[model samples]
Target: MPSAPTVIQHPPRREGLGPPIAAGVVTALVGFTSSFAVVLAGLQSVGATQSQAASGLLALTLTFGAAILWLSWRSKMPVTLAWSTPGAALLASAGMVDGGWPAAVGAFLLVGVLILLTGLLPVLGRLMGRIPTALAQAMLAGVLLPLCLAPFKSLGTAPLLVGPVALCWLLLLKLAPRWAVPGALVVALAVIGIHLGVNGTYLPADALVPRLEWTTPAFSVEAAVGLALPLFIVTMASQNIPGVAVLKSFGFTTPWRSSMVMTGAGTMAGAVFGGHAINLAALSAALAAGEEAGRNPGQRWRAAFVSGLAYLVLAVFSAALVTVVAAAPPGLLEAVAGLALLGTLAAAISSALAEAEERVPACITFLLAASGLSFGGIGAAFWALTCGILVRWLLKPGPLVRKARGSGPRAPRQ
Candidate 1:
């Protein structure tokens, strides 16, 4: 018989320049294409000037990127951070009512404080632990599903550009999942080039320039109830919780509460700098946690630090970068994001329903989560858990003791 392949274990090494650079690029692109676009749109919808929105984006990118790098290095873990996309959506739905930008700042500050408090309070963390895992997974998947679907819809609007990209994605997914995203992006760019060759559409050459202007925070009960609480729920239920799960899936068991504490502290720091919600980034974690990050878990933080430095650079030139990124064809962004997320999506679903008994609860959570239900300023995640728990309780049968008593213990035949 052939000998079994030898398993070689060696100390982790610091990844070379190439992997860190690649990871940084992936992190930056995902941040730009995701809520960074939506946040700009939301702010614009609320009557904020373009400059203000651009400033906010700059603030978010720098704060989150720097925080991730710092914390990941300290913890010796590849802890990637990102803005809470669901929180941004909640902001969009609430619109820019009486307080406008000031309220947003105020809400961000308040939520950050609350998150910090959560970290300090062990009782709260214990309570969160009591919540069933299936429910938590369901809520997270529900929150992220909308984002995953967006890239596919772009094909309808720009078939000539998006179709080729989608095909490329499928091929890569089938043949080589690891390089699918960058590969799809290359194919999309090629398609764009061919179209431009025939129709002669001009692309922008201007760079994004960053400008900073601080808006004083205004606090009100309405803002607290309407914006702050929702932001907290989304950040906690939709971001931090799932982010920890992602790390666990990869077999890393860093202190969960400590990570939360850092994330909360980071959110507060971002608030002071005029950014929106910030939390751990499950997506970016994949970049640093990949085999390329380093064989040794201890060294993966380098990639995150590189990403952080890149974020700082981008923050310095926010306006120019935003314009340049915005000019990219939508298909290029969507196909790349979708291909990148497929693996994560599969892993999440598998973990969400690992137990057969938990499947029903998981299903309930998934449906409620996917429903995008909101009420009285609270977003879908909180409500989905509530509904899922209720269903689980209602469906549970009566205690076996009660059943035995009712049947008179098999008529004492024994």
Candidate 2:
């Protein structure tokens, strides 16, 4: 007899924690170090007075941190959002010349709108699909590599300042993987405490007070072509792409469109609040996704929420937060950031050059990215992709060379 219909049973799935929570916390610390500095740098270039820049910084901190917290919490995903550091660099170098604060704000708003459109448009999804995986991986490596280097470079000036933090980070990584970041922070803080105890004073505080100033959006040919386009490209190519990859790397699958939507909406909020731009945070996501958040990926949202809440608190007292962080000797900040990013850097390099076919191109991309070049109001992140493509094309085998030798399938000779 045809067998009675067979019944199939599926096992219930258990939610668990990942490696990202601890990673997220550590990465967030590093991410926060020079991140706001980029924005302030950009603002200064664009002619923002000290007070305007301070307000802008406060807005950016609050906006990005809150976004990460809210999205992670509501989505029950280890999603994280952060300001686009690369984007800030682009502004600092090129965008400042084209338009002032008004232009920058307009560009930010436009980027948000573009991201929103990208989220809503199915065609954009297909386009994202079309980017070769190897190329995308290389792009991420290119963008993150500089951040990984800053910590080490800062060492030349302040080895004593950075040594203990570096040692603490490495030791914690080896002996207690989960506590590495927190442990390093503790050591750094302890050093600060000791130095202060002996000296009876830390560095004097640099107070920044937020003020209200509304910049009306201004549109110009130069601003649109020069400032806006570059901002959009960096935010999308360098920031959002890697952000999504980090999530997928951890087995989280939310629609790319949805992420685009969140970023677009978030950017708008930031622009209104005097912030430059916000995007997905790859490094911080690593922290929120780590083992400390809980085994269930779904529960890691709490860490994100906590981070966001912390960010808001920082925003409220941004002058104080920035002052404290900035007070750390440049070398120490650099060392801590570099040490924290060691793992992420290793991973990006490994993935970018994994394929023999892509290695030369990827290497070229990485080098260009590390060179710290900016041009015509765009950053190295864009140039790296451009150079990588050029390398791939130049290295491609000629069709004539392939056609000259092969005409027909040969019979197997035994």
Candidate 3:
């Protein structure tokens, strides 16, 4: 027999600057626009002063920015960090605690400690790793469903403002998919500008100056059980776990333990300046880590680094950005957020329903999550995951065994 033909392997193509830059800019825009207001509102709900709210946003952006840069550089992977949007939503709903913002800050610190402990403890890390991808994706889809519906709802409420933005997004999706989100953003900004001009309202001058304020944390049992525990649960279930799954879906290897540790530390650092929680990013992670970020997967880390830089730059102007967002028409931000997240929402649904055996359980998870129900202070995300897992165990013990044996659907490689 002739000797086997020699195999040749080509190295990954080096990515140019454009893809990374575009990816970075998109990631920044989506991350900032989608939920910064929720963060501001949550801070205020807990009784933060206007300066405290601005400081919270600034601290969060800076903390996540540094975390993303450091993690991506260290891992040589696109590792995006984010403040926990769902957790902020939870805070927004939870309202003021007994000790006010100080108690809430104390609760935030406690949550960070819990996250850090989870990372340090092998059992907790293993448990998080064991969460099936389908169920996790389902929960994510559920968490995102309400927000995803915003554009269509906006179309009915403010057709002039949202119709053009949606049309631009669709057109760009067909003609230049990479620019679709940015195009939508441009249309939204233009509409906002027109509205401002027509309404004779201008952005506040003081918005440009970044400010920082600190509140001394006062721990309270009410806040700890009510805010801290629930915030921790939602952040992990709705954000960090899905974030890891997103990375895995893109064939990236993530050191989950280290990521958890870093996010926990970042959250703690941010809490000092009134920031609530920081964690891994799911939707924006895809923007920075996916094929759009770079032709070569190996080089995509640069995109995350660029995103981090963008975030840092955004932090410097966070107050100004908040002012502009606040001044925009009621549904404009929702439209922008929905457009940017459409891709992520579709991907999550696809992933959730990919396996025939897991479909029922995944659907259950999605429905419960989308229902947005909370009980005894715990959010729906956790309950959704728990119910799905229980149903999976009860209905398909065989597949569950295989899953436990590491032979099920090869969940995102890492």
Candidate 4:
């Protein structure tokens, strides 16, 4: 018999709660402030009034916070959960569904049902997995392009309002890459304040209180095919699956069944209160799972736990944040939203084009998505994936893929 493979195990990590606690704080801050604007924009796109949108924001924050706490504690892993930012970006691009807000809410409920079924049925997860990574990423990149362009576009239309926000983002990206978007948001708020003062804008009293608004859901064929399917795909492809991969990188096995079940349930519960979707944290998962959280993988779950508590604390101020956005000059907050999505868009594009053999198919997907094409009841995302995959199959590569595994792997992105 071959000699037993040498077993390697990490030395016991030093005992300390301080590092993980601090990491948790940073994780919450980065996770919330970085993409809250995207959440607001996405809700608005699907026809949410400002008050409804704020309620949606609060619901997502609370539900995911509770989910994270439960999962991390039960699984003993840094199992972070978040509102699906890419899914939000998709909604922002997909625009109003055929049946308006109730239909959109109904679609959100549909996404929840699908996600729950995915958890209960392993085949569903595998089926989603069969969607080619290139096409999926290409669709995401396509959805993101227009939103990402808002910053530079605003530079022409509202230069004074958006210019300083962009400058601050650029400056901090070099000094502290982690804080760039949040920093830009701060500057944008300041600009909004000046604008409000100059114009004597009066903020409504109700905008300062955290509240929940319930919308009775009503499904439509259009919303089911267009809004729900695409949202589910984006959350699964961009956030939930990648979140598992991220924790695995740090040597923690996510409890898949429990995670999906909890997140799916959370999504459904929050949808009645106007929340869109919640999924595993993709990028933010790293903040709680990485070595910065603690040398010991065992203790890092604490970081995720603390981060959950932090989100609940943050939820108290959701209405105020929305109030600020409502008062801001149009395109100013959108400019910040664009800045927030830049990194995600760049990563998506890189991943979509990683395989030299798949570049053409990916481009087709991207262009169709960006073109905002819709047919029948379906939107561009579904059509983009359909066309790209069909094109990819018809044009299979024989030679170009020989070295793709070696050459196309993204050292940074994955």
Candidate 5:
């Protein structure tokens, strides 16, 4: 027989960086625009003044932006980082600690320390893993419940302002779920602008410029347990661990030790300027790692690197964005924030109630979190986790954890 013709496999054509660049831009915009209001709301709830909250937003944007740049560049793994949206929701529910804004800042610092410890100690990471997924998710859902109700609550009071935003959210949610919150936010900004124009309120002269304000940290036992511990747990369970899973699903491995250290250190530094927390990006990581960035996985890190660059650019507008959001008619921005979190709330609920046997404990946890119950100056989030775990153990008296890889549960998509 004639020798078969030799065949050579050819590599994919280079798309000239356009695809990755575009995906990077989308990732940054979606990541930043989607949950920034929650960050502002969370900071304000924990005793930050509007200017301080603005500073917090600025700090978070800048720190995470820098972290992503360094992580992607060093690892070339499309590693991205984000402010912890669930952590922010937890803060929004926790309210002001006994130590006030300084206390909240201290809690943020402690959360960083915990993240660092988790990276350095395998035991600690496993301890975190041992928290039953149902309880952990239930705790997150509970933390989110009150905030998620804002849009509907606003409908009863400020329908004229909130209705349009809600409508925009609904339309996009059905048509393009990814853009739903951002679309709603745009509608809210328009409403704010119209209301401002009619009422003759102009944005502050300095509001357009970004400012970083520093606060001295004060550690309190209450803040530590109430804010810091829960913040760390939520960030780890809901962001970092899932971020690893996300990258893995796309055939990549996260540099867990290095990323934890970087994000931990970055969170500590940002806390001084009033940020809450930062962690590996979860939902948004897909944008960079997916085929949309390019068919070749090796080059996808460019998408993330470019996203980090875009975030740095967005950081410049953080203060201005906060100012505009703050200027909105009451409840308008809350509606937007609520809309932003709806998907998260749904995911949390689903996960928390996934196992038939775990339903009762999860329900109790959810109710406590939603009730915003506080005792001994500790917020409900901590207590909810405690109670849920206790209930599960008391009721079943055995390992209740859902089977998964060596990590906590994957969080709901942001």
Candidate 6:
């Protein structure tokens, strides 16, 4: 008999809770401040009432909070979860459908089912994996372009308030990159407080009470093909795929199927309360799984648990949270969001342009996606990818021609 293969395991290591606690807090703050306003706007664009929007926020936080806690504990990894920010952006751009919020909720449910199916079927996962990374990144970049421009555009309107926040962000980025966004958030809050003191009673006092609202789903063919399909594609391509990549970069073995099932379940739970979608977090995951989270890799899961606890607390105050976000100055919230996403935008652009042969198609995808075009009720993101793939196929040398020329099989680009 052949000798048994040697088994290797990482040594167990644990540390004091201080680092993990800090990491958890940072993760929570970054996750919430970075995109909560966009989420609220997305909900309202689809005709959600103020109460419904608050409930959506609450539902998203609670569902993902529970997921982060359970997945982290069970997997012994820092598996942070977040609402699908790109999906929210897509909703914001798409506006209302014929059936209004009910139709949007139906689309969300359909997306959840699709995500669940992808998890249960290996073939679906493999198909998603085969989507070109350059095109996907280009599409995401296009989706983000308009929102990322908000900071500079706000300079003319709220120069005094926006200036200091931008300045603080830059200073913090240079001095302490990890705390840059939080520092910018602190500045925004300070400005808001001063404005409130001068302007008087911006936010309602009773916005603190937790409220839940439900909308019965009403499916539409337009929404199913337009919103549901695009939401599913972006959530998987831009969020879940990169989320897994983040974990792999940190040396964690991803349990992809289980994560998808859990996220899909969370999305479905959120849909009943008017939330759009929830998925694995990419940026926040890095903060929780990085070296800064803990001295011992084995204990980083504690950070995710703490982050989940913070999310739970936020959920309890969801009504107040939405009110405060609503009270912010026009364009100010977007400025803050834009600043927070600059790094993500940079990374996406770089990734999209890295492959020389794919550059033209990627650029086409980016331009079309950024155009915010809609056709037959479908969003530009879907069309952008389709066009890019078509362009790539057209530009490639034909197999028969290559064989006639005595060239061997061409190697695929990464």
Give the alpha carbon lDDT tens digit for every residue of 270-376 in model 1: 66546677787766567777766666666666777777777777667668545544456654554545555555456557877998878898888877766766576
Q: How would you order the candidates by lDDT, starting with the best?
A: 4, 5, 6, 3, 1, 2
How well is each residue in 90-164 modelled by candidate 3, as lDDT tens digits?
A: 565566778888998998899889889888997876775587878877876786777678889999999998999
lDDT of 5 at 142: 91
Q: How accurate is candidate 1 locally (lDDT)?
A: 0.67
RMSD of 5: 7.1
Instruction: Please give the CA lDDT of all the candidate structures.
Output: 0.67, 0.66, 0.82, 0.93, 0.91, 0.85
Candidate maximizing TM-score: 5
Candidate 2 per-residue lDDT over residues 20-92, each given as its tens digit: 4344555556566535555665665566666666667776777677667667766887777788766665565
Can you tell me which runs of candidate 3 are displaced by over 4 Å? 1-53, 72-80, 85-107, 215-258, 272-274, 280-307, 396-414
> For candidate 4, what is the lDDT?
0.93
Q: Estimate each model's TM-score.
A: 0.70, 0.70, 0.73, 0.92, 0.93, 0.89
Question: Model 5: how far is 315 from its true place, Å?
Answer: 0.5
Per-residue accuracy of model 5 over 116-194 as CA lDDT, tens digit each: 8888998999999998888888999999989999999999999999999999999998999888888988889899999
Per-residue CA lDDT of candidate 4, range 1-414, in tens? 799999999996667899889999999999999999999999999999998999999999999999999999998889999999999999999999888999999999999999999999999999999999999999999999999999999999999889899999999999999999989999998998999999998888877999999999999999998899989999999998899899888888889999899989999999989999999998889999999998888889999999999999999999999998998998987899999999999999999999998999999999999989989967899899889999998888556675674586567865
Q: Please list the residue runs of candidate 6 whose C-alpha ends up more than 4 Å from where it truly belongs after superposition.
A: 1-14, 400-414
Give the Å error, residue 264, model 1.
1.8
| 3 or 4, greater by lDDT | 4
Q: List the residue pairs that clash in candidate 4.
A: none
lDDT of model 1, residue 379: 48
Candidate 2: worst-modelled 10 consecutive residues by lDDT: 15-24
Lowest summed-lDDT stretch of 10 residues in model 6? 201-210
**True-structure RMSD for candidate 1:** 6.6
Residue 76 accuracy (lDDT) in model 2: 80
lDDT of 3 at 162: 91
Residue 288 of model 4: what lDDT? 97
Weakest 10 consecutive residues, lDDT, candidate 5? 397-406
Listed per model in order, the count of residue pairs whose N, CA or C atoms clash below 3 Å is 8, 19, 0, 0, 0, 0
- List residue ranges in candidate 1 displaced over 4 A: 1-50, 85-104, 145-147, 175-207, 217-234, 237-258, 272-274, 289-291, 295-300, 316-318, 325-365, 372-382, 398-414
